[model samples]
Target: MSENDIERLQEVLRDFAKERDWEQFHSPKNLIMALMGEVGELSEIFQWLTDSEASHLEGKVKNRAREEIADVLLYLLRLSDVLDIDLIEAAHDKLEVNRQKYPVAVFKGSSAKYNEIKD
Candidate 1:
């Protein structure tokens, strides 16, 4: 069920888009670009906000961040739909590979990748 959830979600999104005739504009390239655009927008929300200050932000700023995050995710969901990619399974697969590339023992305390650590 976990493996199929993203596909199911994509299907629901596709249906919703179809209902609104949005499929016509959901080309793979456009969706991918839009996904990046949303990411940039989301990042810009905190571009200069200090981490401590950001942590203290509430209400409107938080809501704006949530909306930006949602926009990024929507574009990602639609991008997955356009590419026929199963994001849940794909995410699981990525995590598995990342586990090997970033074992906890070495990468846990730092942000460096397994390959970047000194042997």
Candidate 2:
């Protein structure tokens, strides 16, 4: 999604919390804990799937996976909001760092960590 989309979602979440008087409960720590919980739930959906099964979810499984993904994203966006983080920019910055660390010339098709790759 674009930065504008993220900003819009953040505004919506902020308003939702305000309407429910939930801002008091949306501290960074609380949001992070909730985010982790959602991630675990999402992971559970694929825990038993083989590689092919995991890659190609069907019908109800796909729907359930989508819901879990949405939950994870909501909590993540909320956490970013609480932390005053611009996730889009942060992601771009991290991607640049990753490109430097995993240069394609040396790391293409390789699963090794940066430190494990020899010159």
Against the true structure, candidate 1 reaches a TM-score of: 0.85
Between which residue pairs do clashes occur in model 1? none
Model 1 lDDT at residue 68: 90
RMSD versus native structure for model 1: 2.2
Model 2 residue pairs with clashes: none
Off by over 4 Å in 2: none
Model 2 C-alpha RMSD to native: 0.8
Candidate 1 residue runs with Cα over 4 Å from true position? 1-8
